[model samples]
Target: MIWIDTLAQGILLGGLYALFAAGLSLVFGIMRLVNLAHGDFIVMAAYLILLLVTLMGLSPFVAAIIAAPVMFGIGWGLQKHLLNRTLGNDILPPLLVTFGLSIALQNALLEGFSADSQRLPTGAISTASIDLGVLTVGVLPLLTFGSAIAVIVGLNQLFYRTELGRAFRATSDDATTASLMGIRPGNIFAIATAIAMLVVTLAALYLGMRSNFDPNIGPARLIYAFQAVIIGGLGSLWGTLAGGIIIGLAQTVGAAVNPEWQILAGHVAFLIVLLVRPRGLFPRAVD
Candidate 1:
């Protein structure tokens, strides 16, 4: 019974990780450009939400709603004016640029927010829980898990059912050819990033509600996001969620056995997955 509860908790925890990795997965899938600054952007969004809550006296949910468009603009301008220049045959430039961007964002956040950790004020909802006969689960975790599912489903629909999605697929396949067809790959990239930023805003909301975070924590979050992305198979959204669940389950089960092994166990599971299936549990099919 206890083990069942732990597994359930772990699955819920994976929802948070899936949120972390979704935006990263989207950008990689579309542009093959890894934004090392991705996690910092999420932290930045959290701070933005915190700012709105503090200044406007809005609820966290309302603050996140306000932050979403602002973050989208930031992402759009970033890709349009800067990151797009870093694209092409040379992958090193995007990496170096985003790496620099990551460092700059961290320093900027540190200067603005100081070294203190911060969290969203969730009121009673934070402590709310529900009983399921077998075990009790926090309402916040349940909401987080539901949000993760919604996000993935929405993204899948956007990818498979929309005209913009077709553009995304075309541009992803070949930027030059896409441009030749008047698709404007640069603009598409910017839009893709903007959409990713929206997802980041959603991720940041849950992250702030769930745990305290500081600027320095972004890199650690980045590692987890990267691990989830890799373990899932680069560019595969559904697989990313699976990877997060695997890590979550491993960590929780490890902690159950011995608290000291929690984090290490996740890494070990990732390594085991890589050893068994270097391409990941579900690799995106090549066209």
Candidate 2:
């Protein structure tokens, strides 16, 4: 029964990780460029929410709604002015650029928000729990898990049902070819970044609520997001969720046995997946 509770909690925690990963995976799938700053962007979004909530006494959810569009604009402008220039046949340029961007973001946030740790204010919901026969679960966790599923479902719909998604996939396959066909590769990337920032905003809402966050913590979140994306397989949203769940389970169960083993356990799961499936559990064939 304890195992059951742990597993359940892990799966729910997986949902949060999946939220962290989804934006990263989306951008990577569309453009082979890995944003080393992905995690920092997440932290930035959290700070955005913090600013909004503290200034206006708004709910985190309301703050997220406002921050997402702002983040989208920032992502769009960042890609348009900076990252677009870094794209080429060689992957090194984008990596270097994003690495620099990550450092810049860290310093910027530290200057703006200070190094003090912060947490989202949740009036009643954060501490509330629901009994489900076998075990009690946090309401915030359930909401987070629901949001993760909603994000994936919404993304799937956009990818499969929208014209923009078609353009996105086409550009991913062959940018020059896409350009010849009237889809602007650079523009698509900008839009992709904007969308990725939307996901970051959602992830930020949960991250700040779940634990204390400081400007320096983005890289750690990036690691977990990256592990989830890789373990589940690249370009597959559902697989990303599965990967997060695997990691969550490993970490929680490890902690159950020995408190110090939690972090190590997630990394072990990632390594195991790498060893067993080099291409990931569900790598995309289309791209």
Candidate 1, residues 1-287, lDDT tens digits: the string is 99899999999988888898999999999999889999999999999999999999999999999999999999999999999999988989999999999999999999999989999999999999999999999999999989988999999999999999999999988888998988999899999999999999999999999999999888877777777888898778889999888888898999999999998988999999999988888889452
At residue 67, what lDDT does model 1 achieve? 97
The parts of candidate 1 lying over 4 Å away from their true place are 285-287
Q: What is the model-wide C-alpha lDDT for candidate 1?
A: 0.92
Model 2: per-residue Cα lDDT over 1-287, one tens digit each: 98889999999999999999999999999988789999999999999999999999999999999998999999999998999999998988999999999999999999998999999998899899999999999999999999999999999899889999999989988899999999989899999999999999999999999989999999988999999999989999999999888888899999999999998999999999999998789887454
How much lDDT does each candidate structure score? 0.92, 0.93
User: Relative to the unseen true structure, what is the C-alpha lDDT of residue 61 in candidate 1, on a scale of 0 to 100?
Assistant: 99
